[model samples]
Each structure stands twice: as C-alpha cells, then as structure tokens.
Target: MAKYLIKSDATIKAAKPKPAPYRLFDGDGLYLLIRPDGKKWWRLDYTIAGKRKTISIGVYPSTGLSLARDKAKGARALVAANTDPSDARKAAKVKQAEANEAERRVAEGIPLENSFEAVARAWYAKKSSSWVPSHGDKIIRRLERDLFPWLGARPIGEIKPPEILAAVRRIEARGAIETAHRALTNCGQVFRFAVAEGHIESDPTRDLRGALEPVKGGHMAAITEPAKVAELLRAIDAYRGSLIVRCALQLAPLVFVRPGELRKAEWAHIDLDAKEWRFTVTKTDTGHIVPLAPRAVEILREVQALTGRGRYVFPSARTSERPMSDNAILAAMRRMGIAKEEMTGHGFRAMARTILDEVLHFDAHLIEHQLAHAVKDPNGRAYNRTAHLEQRHLMMRLWAGYLETIKAGANVVPLHGRAAA
Candidate 1:
C-alpha cells in the first residue's frame, strides 16, 4: 500500500537486513521487500476480481531496483488504464513456458544416427500400443541379441544392405540360417516403420535377396500318417509345462485355427451359447468366425474358470490381461517331442488339412473357409452361414471327437457326428 520514491539512505535503513517483512518504494507502485529470511523480492501490488493481487518481478540482487521500478511503472500504467497486471503477467509467463516447451520438443525430435537400440525404442514408443506386449518384447530382443552389437548405432536411414547382410550373416555364421532370415526380416520391418515416420527416405531392406542366402525349399514335414497324428495327440495330452497351454494343445487339433489366432484369444470374443469364437484375422481382410467344437468349447469354458474375469482367455502365465504368446503352443509342441520341421504353430492347420481331406473326405470348401482364406468370387464373398457354416461346424466336431478318441488311447475314425466328442 506504500507509494514510490524513498531516498538511498531511507532504502538502506529499510533494507538493513533483519528477519522481518518490510518494503521500499521505487518511484511508482513498485517496492522491494526484505523478507525475514534475508531474501530480496520485488512486488507490484494491484487488484482484480475484487481481490488484491501482487506480481513479483524478481529478486532484487538478480532483478535490481532500477529494473524493478521500470516493471512496476509499466504495470501501474496498465492498471490505471483498467488492465489487470496480474492476468498480463500470467499470460506472459504462459507464453514463455510454451516457448520453452516447443524448444524441448523440437530438440527431442531431431533425428540422429542412433544405434539400433535407440531407433528400436523410438519405434516402439510410436507403435507399441498397437502391438501385443510379447511382440514388442520380441522385436527388441531380436535387435539386442542379434543386431545391436553389430549395427545398433548405425543411422537407420543410412543403413545399406551390406551392413544389414553383415549383421544377419553373423547369426548365419552360428548356423541358424532361418534365424538369420528372421533377423533380416525383423530389421526390414523396423526400417520400414522408420521410413513411415520420416526417419528415412527409403527402406534399405527392400532388395536384400542376394545378400542373405535364400531358403532351400522342398516340402515341409507334416503329420501325414494317422497313426503318427494319434501318437502326437497322446504326447500333447501328457505335456507337463503349463496346464493352460495343455488346454491350448488339446484345443489346437479340435478347432485347428491358426496357432496365433488361438493363442491370443481374448475373453470378449467367445459366445458359448452360440458355439462361436469371433475374431479378426489381420493376415486376411475379413473377420473370421471359428465354429467351436463341443470339445473346443469345453476347453474354453475350463480355461475361463481360471481366466474368465481377466482380459485374455489364454492369458500369459507371466502376466494376466494379455494372451499367451503365439510361441506358447509351439513350445508345448517341442515338449511333446514334435520336431519344428515336422510341425509348427501354423502347421496345426496343415496337420488338420491333411487329415480332414486325405483321411475323412470333408468338403474342401468347408476346410478353406474354416482356414479363413480369402474367397475371391463375389458370390463366395457374400456367403451365408448355411453354406460352409454347417459343414464347418460338422468338420470341427468330427475333428474334435477324433482328437478326444486318440487322446483317450482309443482307435478312432473322424465321422460327421451330432454329439460332443
């Protein structure tokens, strides 16, 4: 409330350094406060919203008395003209803070030639929410274990095929040609994602055909023998690693959906009363309906006993809320003495295909539809639930019963049937 203009001697006497709140006038509404803690603070007192407001320009030693006076005079002029100095001060502070924030963000966005780890992290932050957690972890694990030491720090945009080939070739040197290919493919995807984000001009992984050795092709080993299929089922029933995966294993042959589709099942997708499991297959454009067999439904219900209230049906034992990784079934296969070349995650479909067509003679159209393959014919595209629906439901139940019979150590032939296996 004190007004301006105290002489130097009067100011010195006021600022004599004591533990008390006192003010010195500086030729306007501004004043310097000597806080009891021996700190100097400048205050310009005013009013707004029917309330007294004080704006602190700064501390005196840091924001000297002359400058404090100039700030007070400017604020006083605004007040006399019916402007609120407090709101103006707040607005200016906000502008300064916004400027600082913009500077920080711009600096953070400046792309550098980062290591594989850095780019992987940036890509992850941008894309992780869309991906399953296990998928995100696998991406980083592959980069760290396979590519980081060799090429992690190389700028992604500057990465050439030879550098990529060299990194992949390191894994190949350890005699894992498939792993070498997988590493290259994973890196290619990361590069593509980087390109989408304007981190690179083009993908360096586009034409690495000659760089990494091409895979030798023949025929994939499949469980073609009925006796062998029975043996495999028996082995699966006897698995000891995880009970949830065991249920998945038992359900695999019955439903015979893609291993990934089955493994990553969420709780909301099932309709037990309707005998359907609805899920989208991203590999194929259309949403798929898996007609659950009585056995498949039974397994799902049993799985739900432990996980129904949770987010994912086949939730990872490591964590709830997310489905088990796609590898969960394949790993169970390994424990059951099934070789990778003999069978794989997707090989469950192939396994069912061979048995259903060669052995049981179910219609090919039903099998294809059940596999969720794209049917290009416009009429086929507009398929009713009646067309492949009855056949698929029948095929699934028959397959389920056949598995149950084999699992029970009984010699069984798959039959189009009406009851639960």
Candidate 2:
C-alpha cells in the first residue's frame, strides 16, 4: 500500500521527464511511471502469495488518472482473491483480439453462414484449373441449377442428410434419375471439401448411400454387328451434309474418340508428318495420342486445306471462330434415319470397344488405351496419353483396313486371332 498523491490531469500533463525512471503514486498499488524519454505509463504493483509483481495498466491520457486508479482498485480485488491481475489482463487482451478478428472477417464479406453454395464456389475456384473448360462449366452449372436454389444460403454445418435428399429428390422428380445421382455425387464432393477445409465438422452426404433411385445401367446405343456396322458406314458415306460433318463421321469410328474430343480437335494438335493427333482429352484432363491411319491422314489433309488457318480442325459451318456443335454428328445420324434408340454420336466409342475387343481380337488393354479409357500399367499406374504408341499405330491402321473390308461387303473373321501381332 502507498499514500495517495497524484490525482489531477493537470499534474499528469505537467510532470517532467526525470534523469532516471520515477513513479507518482495515487493509492494502493497504482502509480503513474515516468521515464527520461518523457513517456508516461500507468502501472499497477501488486502481490499474490506474498510475491510482488508489476503490470502495465495503460498510458497517460489514454488511461487518465481516475481510470488508472479504477484499474488499480480492480487489480487489488483480484490479488485479494489470489488471482494475478496481469494474467486477467492478458486473458482480456486475447478475447479482444479474437473479437477484432471476427469483426474483420465479417467486414470482408467472408461468408458467415458457411453456406453450401459459398463453400462449393470456393472449392470449384480452387479446383477448376485442373478441369477442362467445359467440364468446369458443367460443374458450376450443376450447382447453380440444382443445389443453390434450395440450400445456398443455409449454414452448411447445420444441414442434415434429409435436407440434401430433399434437394436431390427434386432432380429425380423430373425423371432425371441419373442426373439426381450425379448431383448427389457433386454434393458429396462439396460436403467433403467443407470437412477438409474445416468449414464443417462432418459431411451430411456420407450417409446418403442407397438413398437415390437405382439408375438403369444402359450402354449408349451402338451397332456392334458386322452387318450393321457396314450398313452404318454406308449411311455415313451417303450423308449429304457439310463436308466437315461427313469427314467427321468418316473418321469417328476409326479414331473412336469421345464426340467432344473429336469436334474440339484443334489444327495445332494434329501433325500429319508425325501421323499423330496429340491433345489433352477433355473427359479425364489427360493427354491422348491418336495414331493417324493413312486414310485418316488423307481426311485430315483434305479438311486442313479448308480449316488449316483457323484454330479448330472442324470449324463450325456457322462460324470459323468456334468448334462445331457437339450435336453435329448426332444430327447427322438422325438425318441418316438412325433413330436415337439405334445410335448416337457416342455410339462410335461403344462400337469400336465391342468390335475391337470381340471381332478384331485386339488386346483389351490396347483397345482400352486407344479408347482413352483409364488403363493401368503393370505397376498399377495409369498409362499416359502416348502409352503403347507403336502398337496403337498398328492397331489404328488395321482397324481402318478392317472397316474398309467390311464396307466392301467382305465376310471377315477375326484374322485367326492375330490382333496382338
């Protein structure tokens, strides 16, 4: 305890700096400490368990004489209770810092709801770089159309399984059973992302197993029979549309690539001298190499004469600035009297997979690689785009000649199982 002396604001303002550090006591353990540098600090001296300790209350003007006395009175109370006032002050500072951080985050418009749409957009922005442009667009579009309307503003941490199911049931109600499943899968991904990012404690979608209607596992419509394959080839030859569409139809079964990959093929990705078409496949975002058969190269050369100066090999008949519509081949199929149930643009992939594996008797792995399907190596690693290049080149030539023979009405067997050779 000390006698009360310093009190008035005028005395604090008039106090001069000393040659050494000095203190002006108010009462109890409270005092105003002055240094030779002219800075004034309010300090509290206290004892707990008979040990002396000092703590800064604040500064003069910032903490006036009256306020400093009041702080010292509070410190004396804590010390009487066997608690360290310095420790209490530190705790208060920590709480204040936390409050300040939360306020700053709120001011920044950071989502306080941690809503499903908010977290999903963050995840997509982080992940979209790896996806093909159209693939990224499709993902965000799925969220915008399906999930955002219902749960975009709800706090994701509070969302339960039934809420997610209700959202998906809306998709299923429209007979989009497959789309419902896909939407659920996307929701699961977002929920998992939130869990990983610590935005939520758990994913509500984990327990949604068997919640959606079982989707019918149906293959894309394709003509795998040799007679039917020949008839489809004749129909393609007879298709009297744009030359670009005809050439695309002619090359589709030979390359057996996905429709998007074929239509979006850039001229820069093709090198006739190398007899290779190299580009990243949109579906898997992995490199793919299509070995150009002699006939395929011929078609490329003919098309290049027209579209060589542009970006896409098959620049749209409507605009050279863009790739042809994805439905170009499908529309051609329709015009050729091929019903939707009979075939589709994607049917070429199915046809090639069936005929190459069963009829041509090629190695299943090689066929899978040619189809740009994910095929793992002996070490259980996936083969890169150019995997089995020489073998694939040989297979492409043989496949082209096989299609030519079929078109000529030649009855062919599996060449005595000689595909591997």
Query: What does candidate 1's lDDT look like per residue over 215-273, in tens digits?
Result: 65312455767777878878876888777888888787777777667877887888999
Q: Candidate 1: misplaced stretches above 4 Å?
A: 1-122, 155-157, 194-201, 214-222, 237-245, 282-286, 301-346, 357-368, 373-375, 378-391, 401-421
**TM-score, cand. 2 vs. native:** 0.73
RMSD of each candidate relative to the true structure: 12.6, 5.8
lDDT of each: 0.74, 0.87
Count backbone overlaps in model 1: 4
Candidate 2 residue-wise lDDT, 1-96, digit = tens:
334488599888888998998888886777888899999999888878878899998998888987888888888898889889888889999889
Pairs that collide in candidate 2 are none
Q: Give per-candidate clash totals.
A: 4, 0
Top model number, lDDT: 2
